[model samples]
Target: MAQYRWSYTSLQGKRYIVGLFHGPKTGHLMIYVNSKIVQIDFKVFEEKVYSFFLEEDLCEITIKKDNGSYGYDFQINKEVDTPLNRKRKAFNKVNRNRIITMFVGLGVFLAVIITFGISQKRKKEREKERYLQEMLAKKTVSATATIDSVKWSGDQASFYFKFYEGDIQRARIELIDKAAVDLYTQGLPVLKGDEFMMTYYTYNDSTSLKLNEPTNLQLANFMYRAFEQEQKSQSHLSEEELRCRVKCAFRVSGISGLADVYFQAETRESNPWHNRLTYNKLVRDIPFQEAFNEYCLPQ
Candidate 1:
């Protein structure tokens, strides 16, 4: 039940907000200019076009029902006014166009920087590999390592593994390839606790996976289930009630990617916040209530 809102500015810099409202309950179509209703009509169908003049420019507002939310089309002086144009003229007026142009230029500049950075990173990786080859002369160690955790920083991934070797400060070795990624995961998206015998080379304080490439990495099945859970939990309700929530975020600890969980309780609507009560099962099974409303809903 939202009215389609738009605004226009004349050549003399006079601006006015134009709103087209088609009430579903009242079945009335109304056009408002500067918050004042200029035209009203009764209609059973949802499609209509209202035309008016703003200064010397002819304006047209079209309300056509679509599968999604209704499409509201606005035009002035025979040319359709897109949302981008409306935003540029209505809200920003003077500085938005400049800011937008500068942003586009800045984006191009950042793209160049990112390309340069990737080239440098790959070059450094190659140099390190070459140095290892020169000193170690293709020597490799085969050891069984239990996957501790896996983490990703952009396209590069680091795998933390545990072995009986005395040096146990969780040194990171990035050898990203599809075969290695498939070898460690426990059929879950973020694979851990799996054991595999891998050949590696050590240089100074860093380790590298020999020549194998990691590829064909697919995300876990839980993503679809999580999205379904979110949608199912979004059913609307009329009244408000008490809700309690528990939330957690993944935190890096030593080498384990364990969760840092938080708990809170709030009194809000059933659609946005759960109306059912929740308890802090860890701390003596106490019910968390409205007093703890600084909550996080998992959405």
Candidate 2:
């Protein structure tokens, strides 16, 4: 039997059925424009097929025989230029904005890099100047004694105090090393005007003899010994002995390298944090009477 294939376009934005026809005796079947076959019901003596036409972006239909073999053919016009033009316009706007933003960001990044480089250069120059000054100072002082004493002006370590033999009014030079200072000051509560003292025995031009206690441990041991001695003494003590013999705990702190001794003593009295004292140049902590005789005036 002769058959005819039909094709058309849908005006509405939907699929509209076109036509249905008989199968061909030879070659593949071709369906067009939104056309499809609901059923062909092919038997042993029959050959029937189905097909469809599709827009470029739309759905399509297929055709099959009773043996489960299938084929597809699409009828399409040329791709439209309108949608392509719209997409190109959108892409151009986005690319222009992206290029402008990239240029601005690049400028800011370059400015930051320049600023950091300049700051780093200035810092390096300043450090070099400081180093040169320190070197010059060291050279000038290299010929003089390592330890120089201006006067007993401000606070200083007690260990550095100078004392002379036989002379009570004035003294020559006393070099109490750090270890001795720590030992003598141990267990003695911090008192007012506690200070560090250092003496420079200028033997020759470039050398000076310096000696003192070695460590804080030595000082602590000395204090414990003093406390024990005081306890053993049978002297009839007055109010002064009462203060010295009172049980106390100490909190200690100091600067690194420099021998600065700061101590706070908590007495068994009304206030726990009653007495506090600091000594920059700590030599030793003697009884008030002893200290007055040794360092201050005639007894």
The per-prediction tally of clashing pairs is 6, 32
- 50-125 in candidate 1: lDDT tens per residue? 7877876778887778764467788874445755456556667568788888999999999999999999999999
In candidate 2, stretches whose alpha carbon ends up further than 4 angstroms from where it belongs are 1-108, 111-115, 118-126, 129-133, 136-222, 225-299
Q: Rate the local accuracy (lDDT) of all candidates.
A: 0.51, 0.38
Candidate 2 accuracy as TM-score: 0.25
- Candidate 2 residue lDDT tens string, 134-234: 76555432111122232332343432233332233222333434444334443333332223322222333122223232235434543444344334442
lDDT (Cα, 0-100) at 177 in candidate 1: 57
lDDT of 2 at 34: 45
